[model samples]
Target: MKDFKFVSKTQETLKIALINFALLLIFVELGSLGWYFVKHKQFFYTREKTQNKSDLGINLEGVRLNQSIVERFHPFFGFIQQPSADFRPGFKVNNYGFISPYDYPFKKNKKNQFIIGIFGGSVASDYSIFQIQNKILPQYLKQLPGLQDKEFVILSFATGGYKQPQQLLILNYFLALGQELDMVVNIDGFNEVALSNLNNKNQINLAMPSIQHILPLTSLANNSLSTKAMQTTLRIQENKTKINQGLESLQHCSFAACDALTSVYVQNLVNNYRKDVVAFEKERGQNQQDDEGSVIYINKNKSVLEDSAAFEQMAWNWAKSSIFMHKVLSASNVPYFQVLQPNQYYQTKRVFGEAEKRIAFNNETPYAKAVELGYPALLSKLPNLQKNNINILNGVNVFDKTKDAVYVDSCCHYNKAGEVVFSNYVGSSILESLRKDEARSKKK
Candidate 1:
């Protein structure tokens, strides 16, 4: 009876200790949760106080990309801008799907319509936009003799990320369609160098479209992973989109961290998403070997990243494209001139202020290195362009004297002031060259 009492007392004590430990855990959990939320409340905005105005107040215009822009492949050229896919108010894509908010009409009603088609990549596109708004170049040309009576209209063939042969292709395609161009001014060089090297880096054909053009299409070609990934990713992305846009409202929550519980849920979803994406990519890579028919990948000659020999070949290809363009234009009796667009990467070419340094210069980008290495090769081929009877203007020194910020972006783009200087120089060169030629013809 004494031994039984001792064992029963020990069992009762163990039960009491376990119950007290469980109670302490529950107390600690509640206390911690309450403290975390209370600390957040003291500093963070409340949904009631802020009135969820962040959704309305936030301007994502600068950050928002043109993913909404629908792209379609062209037979002659790689892709043209499709009609009106952008959601921004008053912004419209042309019928040809080029960047401008205008149309390339088939019918030319005006007689002596000297349509000066501007060709090149995005910098050229910006120049076209400037010309369309200001009429700077045409005005300068009009001041020259024998060009006054001609009705000049701007036709922009420039697209973002277009390189050599694409410009040549664009010129040929339009001319084949019975569109008349009196002159062609191709603004290029940067795309020809940067994007071609990029193509080789991506292990694709140099003749193929830039990686930006092809990379988005790569995911959709995954055979088995497509259907599975699309379903899961669609749902997750839908939730993520709502969360990012602040469209999914939670009770008494603000922008910063929203609600901790909701944050936990989002984080969980993100972890699952990351896991899904990795699996999707892995399976996609494996599938590409087996399902080659789905992708337009060719086992073409690919050089390693930023090879000097490869860069030389790219510059040669650029010159050759210009030569080909000259042949086509000459056969049609149209004057063709190419302006090698100015770049920030050209060493000691421009003096960068703090603004330019921050926004326009990135030493880490492949562009700086590409320009540094590839530009010498490209510049060396300038004589090759000139030898082909192509009136090529080297615009590298366009901003040499100007201490102001000319380059707006890191990837070889010019601002409004840059545009103004470039356009004036281009216009003046064209006019003066034509005048000199005219005077020579008269003397002869």
Candidate 2:
């Protein structure tokens, strides 16, 4: 009888333990639900730092920020980088549709104020915003002769994937807005040679803006409608976005359960998902359409005669556009220099450091052949440009002698050292040109 009593007591204890455990789970879930209803945010969250591993040439956040960035077209200048904050730290798009912290268009142009405007594609934009503003303007350029008494203001009217006449159009657009400049620096050639065909040619008119700026608008206009593979991509993109949301809320997460390591793992999985999606889209021949409602043309005044762009025509357009820009700027007494930007495929002209070999090149890039074949066409136009009295600098060989790691990525961008090198050369040219002008004026 005593043994039976002991068994009964043990059964009661086990039943009570199970019941308590169930009640505890219910309590936690109910509390979590209550928290969500009050805050309108997920209770469980995590943190992660993003690494760009895809060669999409654009980040997903940039694509999704349609109103402020690309995926929208401007009627005047093909497309403008609408003034808005970018994801990069300390990046602010000024009111003039350029990347700058200050609204230079409205900033009081002081006496002896020297406004140096940069025009081109991504390289020029990066050079203007980062290198010129941070290093060259302060350390190198400001120390130049004839600039000692002048207060410098920078205007970076460049955009990503910009080519020839687009830079010309940007200058005209801003000048029409009554913006003034003491000097203009245009870094171009690569986009003219490479993206002209990539962005246009069988896709849109060769004269239109970069296709990077086009497809997104079409996708948005179609209301996310796409092929099955693209649908999968869209789903994964949404998942990545949600993951990013949770990743963003880590510091503010009230729950003690926000796991940083788990967040990184989740992000990595999504990154791989993105890679798979890309491959799947390619395999399935996922249709990327230029929908009927998607095309917006901006070759007003019809400067471009060709329906499709070839290498020679693109180089011609580049030369003519620079010639026109120099004429316009020269009329206003603004010195202009056209710089052909640096590219990695051209790295064969010089020996690259181990670091450059590791990070700066991808043989698989679509631009490799285009650069090899198309760059020669651009180079051929140099004598014609010089004949027009347009100040021209062939910067294709800028990294020819540098054993230092200069290029930043597989694309045509540069690192700090590269930016410094590019700026130093530009500064030297500016000094020489100013001295020559002074001499000419004295002789007159």
Candidate 3:
């Protein structure tokens, strides 16, 4: 009986010990969770605020919600104007569409003629003196004998770093505002792939953070992190300062020791930027097909159009956006033309430097592949466009390297000389098209 009693007591003690251990574990877990919440409260709050302040609708004018100010202006001179000369540098917001600044507002006349608007990135926005003097298509068109009375307004609406979806958004915005346009010309290639990877879908709706606002905080934090890490690492090394000073001396110590230390420290910060980018892309969704059977990569949030199916959904999105502009102009009985700009690599493959070659392949060359896949898919849909009487001015042929061309570096943004060449080509094409239309009208 004593043995039985002893066994029972031992079992009871074991059970009690096990219960205490389990309780301890539970308490530790809860405490850890609570600590984490306390430590990251500000991060959570800021994320929540950003989410809550999400855009209600698309901003057509590229106005920022917080500042309620216009960062850029669309002037009659075919150039984007900054707020003021004294305003902060790099404050201009370029267009978010396929429109270019290659053309300017002209004196209106009673000739019920077609007015073509050109749009795209910097290639379309080439308004340098060289371009104006030699390559501006509008200038050439104005002087053409065939298009004497036919006015062609090549208003460029392309902005740097704008992607396909943003261009569509801009077209939709302008259409809503009831701007009568005849046709749209797009010179796209460089920004399509790169900006597609960024996370700024609502750029037009929100105010871009100022460079001045970011620089000071970044400098201070960088300095603090470097100072702490360096002090910790060099605490015991007697010759550490000597080595560091020698390295600094090699560069003439242009920056103070503290600055270098700060840079090293700040660069080590582990950020969730990659995670945020992934989340944004997932939210944007896949590309859609266009009327041309081309699969266009669209931000999955937008609407789909027929015949745009075969183009890379992103490319298709951009093309569809351009097509949408054409529809708007057609509805308003405004005439316009669309031009597909060539990637810079296609224009200057021979002169590319090592780094330039890599960037050309990674950044600009993919459009050619997209076009190859898109063209066959879109071939059948050409008739539908013809039915709409939309004159498609395909400039992809101009990208042929067999012909000498000038582009800015290895990217699609053309240099002054290149812009002039492209503009002249565009002008010639417009004149020919107008002459054909005149003949057709006479025959009718």
Candidate 4:
């Protein structure tokens, strides 16, 4: 009778263990679902499209979103700008893949049209604080009696993360397509510095190693865990800080520790948020090499030059490309200008907002340091630009007068208010150039 009692008790204990195991599994499943919901709803902005392209008058014949830009596959430049699905401000793309709100053909309109093609990276691509083409800068400029009679058609051919050579390729493509441009302005600097130094590659078109390739997987995973633990502590401390106004925000972790956490956070955020979309959504090599003649791979056996020297060489290459483009445009008597876009890193005496402060504090990355170190090299080449007969605008100094915040989310981009400053600066410079050209014509 005692043995029977012992067996029955053992069976009861086994049943309880199984029940607890089942309950634990259920809890894990529920927690995963909750995490997934919060991640998607709070972080990702995804939309499903059921509308036909024909209804929108958009031809998706050779288009792909390599980096979230609705760009068409170009044989010469890798990709060219198209109307992006990411954001909308009532803008339309021309049939040739140029972003334009007005109904105009890709070719010159034969109306004495003063066609200006503005090319650069994302800042100049209307991916910043404002859709540059939709802004009132052009309208404001047209109101000037000096420009009232002229028909202005400003075309934007810029793309995010594009370097100077890409702009040159775009110009070459335009020249090939028989589209005449009056003044081609290239706004650059940040992308050139960032891409050049980050990859340790002197050339622009070569693909740089991704963050996953740069950082060790083991370190990334371990650091990720450490960050999460620190974040939990930070959150609790922050709550206390809120309650006690005398407490410092960085009571738990040092600034460097926080920055390390932030770097990992940004990397994970990008990995989690970016759609698992392949390049061109097809087998690679759909887009033939556009940089065949221009790209010259640096010899790795030679000792690596200092960051400044390498950056200066990169700047010189850009200047040479600009010179090549000048010859290309001068064939049609088209004037061209290169504007070195302003960056927050260059603004030494600028005030920082809360969001700006976070970005500023996280500038220890190789990419950020490269931009900071390499910018001076480019700026020092201004005399070389002048010697080449290139009318380059020093946009690096454009933000000096504005006491208000100029930068937006990133290091190089600016707010709409900042965009106004940029537009006015470029407009005034363009106006001055036009006046000089007109005066020269009168001399003839």
Which predicted model would earn the best lDDT? 1
Off by over 4 Å in 3: 1-116, 127-135, 143-154, 175-183, 189-311, 344-388, 399-405
lDDT of 1 by residue, 89-132 (tens): 33356778776555664456788667888999888987887787
**Candidate 4: tens digits of C-alpha lDDT, residues 1-444:** 999999999999999999998897667555544543453332111222223321221211112212222234444554545544332344555454545554333666567676778787777775322435454445555654566777767777776556767788878876677766766878887777776554453232223221112222222233432343334334434433332221122122233333233334433433322212221111121212332332322222134466667777667767777788888887778888788887777655556677656643444334567667777878888898888888888887787777777664444666657888888887788667766777887899
Off by over 4 Å in 4: 1-74, 80-87, 92-98, 102-105, 109-112, 127-146, 201-305, 353-355, 359-361, 440-444
Per-residue lDDT for 114-221 in model 3, tens only? 454445655555532233234455565656455556645444455444445445555665656554455666555445433332222321111122111222222233
Task: Locate the minimum summed-lDDT window of 10 residues in model 2.
Answer: 53-62
**Candidate 2 lDDT by residue in tens digits, 1-444:** 999999999999999999999897667656654554344334343323234222111223113221333324566766666667653445566665667666756445478877888899888888886653465643545555667777777778887778878899988878888887888999988888777756443344555666545555555556643455456656666665655554555434454323333344545645655455444433333225444454433332224334324677778888999999999998988889999887887545788878678766776666777787778888899999999988888888777877788876666878778887888787777667667777888898
What ordering of candidates by lDDT runs from best to worst? Answer: 1, 2, 4, 3
Better model by TM-score, 2 or 3?
Answer: 2
Candidate 1's TM-score reads 0.69
Write down the lDDT of every candidate, Cα atoms only: 0.69, 0.66, 0.42, 0.55
Q: After superposition, which runs of candidate 2 have C-alpha atoms over 4 Å from their true positions?
A: 1-70, 86-90, 107-109, 137-145, 199-203, 222-309
Clashing pairs in 2: none
